[model samples]
Target: MKMWFLGTGAGRPNKHRNVTAIALQLPEPETGWWLFDCGEATQHQLMYVPLKLSKLEKIFITHLHGDHLYGLPGLLSSRSFDGGVTPLAVYGPIGLKAYIDTVFSLTETALDYEIVIHELEEEKQGIIYEDGRLRVEAGPLVHRVPCFGYRVEESDTTGPLLADKARALGVRSGPLFGKLKAGEAVTLEDGTVITPESVTDGVLRGRIVTVLGDTSPCEMAVLLGKNADLIVHEATFAAGLEEKAHEFGHSTTIEAARTAQLAGAKQVALTHFSGRYSNDELSQLVAEATAVFPHAIAATDLSMVKIDRVHERRAGQDEISS
Candidate 1:
């Protein structure tokens, strides 16, 4: 899976960054992408990416904050003009349905496609969404408003069939091989039972990615990010501003890294940066985060990061780029 940062600034947009919006490009067989937070001007940011509104299947809002979801109405409206006919499902905290309804009602806007809004219960924590291919778990986060963090887990895939092993075991490359690959035991013409475990490689473990809303470092954050391949945490301030960050219900770069460490995550992407830091100064946040967790990166606007199933374990590596 790949993540495209549409906006990375906190609270408001600046010259360098927009607000907090991220587009997660789903893997194959799924042609669409899932949007994280839809901050102000998020649709404008989408103009620069390869993503399309028609292909947006699911949208997960971390909170009801303006910086997190102010762009929802415009984006949803624009989708109709952009030929987005597929039904879209939006998952968020309570009051979300009312917010969307109020906007659409006041604006007298009509959508060609259906918009399904799911309002999560207050402080509810568990699987919010699940399908045959992916499962999403939501956990309450410590924020000024009712906020949440999401853990997206891809389903484990079957490993490739060992053609050489099957051939050696008198298994022909026909329907018998297909049956064995499908985890069914097949009896060959020679009366040899071939089990999938004996001929195929082990299962390939799926990847887990955690995306958090604006929050102070909390135990729930750790729980949502536990053993995640990548955790996208909000680092709204640098290390020295921990007090200010927490006062605003936000996290410092150090706190984000600590949460990643406590959660045993493989990598951390620090985002939701404050506009006080200039473009060049954003590196300071990355430096502070890397001090506590080596695999930490400061996400920049329009940057893209690829999350691999296999952990690279490289320290101080900047894998994301604009």
Candidate 2:
């Protein structure tokens, strides 16, 4: 998985950052990429990245804020023109569906594929998306609007089967070997039992990532971020301006770092910076976050990042561990 930030500014777009859009490129089983938020002019930003609209499988909107959704309609239309035939699934708060419906209706636009919208009720919580490979949950975040934070968890994969050991044990290639590879115990013709534990190497831990919209330091953000490999939180202001940020339902760099620390997340990416800050000022923002969480860093537009992978190696004969 890789994250590409298309826009990362608060309130409006600047030469440095745009509003708020992020593209997460996932591997096999998942098509193109999943967009976090479609802020204004997000499609234009795609030129800097390798993502194509035709490959977008899903779109998760954090809120109905203009900065988070204004570019959606255009992206949708352009996607169709760009040969996006795959059905798109969009999830968000209550007004999300209505907003998209109204926009498409008003513009009299048509697309090549169907769109399935999953709208969450006020403060709704629980898994909003789940499949064989991915599970996404929504938790309400503290903001002026009914904003949300999303937690994306991937499914774990079984480790490779030790074919060499099996062959050495006289377990010839056949159905028994297939069963053993699938973690099933097999009784050979010799009446000896072979278990998956004796043949498998390890369990690959799935990745977890949390991406939040505009929000203040809140418990929901912490809940979604818990144990996440990466926490993408807003750093709309510097440390000393906590009061102002709080007033606007935003968070400072320090607060974002504190959330990552409290959530026990492995890494943090600070985004949604205030336009007033130039590159130098943004450095201070990253510094404050890193001071609290060593892995914290400021994310820039078009910068790519990956989640930390955790693999559990099978341990002793009695118990398997990572």
Candidate 3:
């Protein structure tokens, strides 16, 4: 799995950053990408990446801020024009359905595919989405209006069983190894029974990523992000301008870094930067965050972060016995 920052500017668009949007890309049986927040000019930003609009299956809106959702109508319209046929599910706070209706009604535009809107409330916190390999959850975020942060965790996978190890134990290169690899016990012609534990390792660990919407440093965010491989938080201000962040229900760079640190996240990527700051200023902002949490980085538009994958390998039988 990978996360591509489509737009990272906070309040508005800038020459360096466009607006708030991200593409969460996962591999097969969960192929395609899901978008979080569709800020202005989001389609244009997609041009930089090799994403097809038809493969955009899900959209999660954090809030109703114009900077966070202004590009929805345009992108939806463009999808229809581009011959997109796949239905899309859009999850957001209440009034999202009404907002889409009003925009489409006034613009006289129609989409070619089904668009399902899921209006979320604060009381709800669980699995909001589940597919073959993806499980996405939503939790409340502390914003001016109803806001939510999302945690996307891939389902666990068990990698290949050790063929050499199986052969070493008198298991031949036939269906017997396949059975043992699948965690099933098999009896050989010689009446020897081989168990799955004898030839295979345990279950492999999957990657977990948590993405925060516009929010302050809150307990809910920390809890949702706990033990995450990657924590992507909105950093709308530097520490010096923390008052502004508090006023707007956003996080400072330092606040984001500390949240990731407290959540035991392996890495943190700070985004949703205010456009007012220059490149040098944003660099300084990241430096400030790094001081607090060295694993933090200020993400740029179209930048991708590759997560570390953990696979299980069989231990030697001698070590297992020991």
Candidate 4:
């Protein structure tokens, strides 16, 4: 899995950054990718990356702010125009469906594919989406508006089959081997039963990623990001702006890092930067975060973070590439 930061500005766009938009690209066999917070010019930013609108499976909106959602209507229209035939699922706070419907009605626009909107209730927290391979949970955060944060947990995979051990136990390399690999016990022609655990390694644990919307430092953020491999938190101000940040329902770099540290997150990607700071000044913001949490980095526009499948839990830092 990988996260692509398409835009990373606080309230508005600037020459240095756009607004807030991030894409979580799943690994192969799952052709679709998920989007989080479609800010203005989000589709335009897509032009620079290899992601496709037709392959966009879901969209998760953080809040109703213009900077976080103004690009959604155009992006949905463009997806249809680009031949998106599959259905799309959009998850967000209440009133999101009305917002999209109003926009489409005003513009007299129609879509080619089905769009399902899930309106999350304020302060309601629980699992929002789940499938065989992955599960997503939502929790409320302390924001000016009713906002939510999501925790994505990938399901653990079965371990590889020990072919040599199976063969030694008189289990032929055929359908029986497939069944053993799937954790099913199989009886051979010789009446010998071979169990899955007896001929396979242990299961491989999956990775967890937490993505938060705009919010002040809150316990909900820490709960959502608990023990996550990566937490994408907003850091709208530098270290000395804690009072101003909390007053506006936002977090400073130090506060963001503190949340990550409290949550025991392995790495934190700080985004949603205020335009007051230029690109060159981001290093200072990162410095502030690293002082609290060693594995923290300031995310910039068009940067990407690769999350490898967790083989074993260890203490280390992940890298973000631009």
Whole-model lDDT per candidate: 0.90, 0.88, 0.86, 0.91
The weakest ten consecutive residues by lDDT in model 3 span 313-322
Number of the top-ranking candidate, with lDDT as the measure:
4
Q: Please list the residue runs of candidate 1 whose C-alpha ends up more than 4 Å from where it truly belongs after superposition.
A: 170-193, 311-322
Question: Candidates' TM-scores?
Answer: 0.92, 0.92, 0.89, 0.94
lDDT order of candidates, top first: 4, 1, 2, 3
The alpha-carbon deviation from the true structure for residue 27 of candidate 1, after best TM-score superposition, in angstroms, is: 0.9
Ranked by lDDT, the better of candidates 2 and 3 is 2
lDDT of 2 by residue, 62-152 (tens): 9889999999999999999899998999988888988988999999999999999988887878998898678999999999999999999
Clashing residue pairs in candidate 3 (N, C-alpha, C atoms within 3 angstroms):
none
Which regions in candidate 4 have their CA more than 4 angstroms from the true location?
A: 312-322
Put down candidate 4 lDDT per residue, 223-313, tens digits, no spaces.
9999998999999999999899989899999999999999999999999999999999999999999999999998889999988775432
Error of 2 at 127 (Å): 0.7
Model 2 / residue 246 / CA error / Å: 0.9
User: Would you give me the overall lDDT of model 3?
Assistant: 0.86
Which stretches in model 3 have alpha-carbon errors above 4 Å?
Answer: 28-30, 166-198, 312-322
In every candidate, how many clashes are there? 0, 2, 0, 0
lDDT by residue (1-322, candidate 3, tens digit) is 7789999998789888889999988765566888999999999999999788988989999899999999999999999887788999999999999999999999899889999899997657888988756788999988898889999887765556778888887899888877876668888779989888767665556789998899998998998899998999999888987788888899898999999999999999999988778766777988999999999888998999878666655564221110
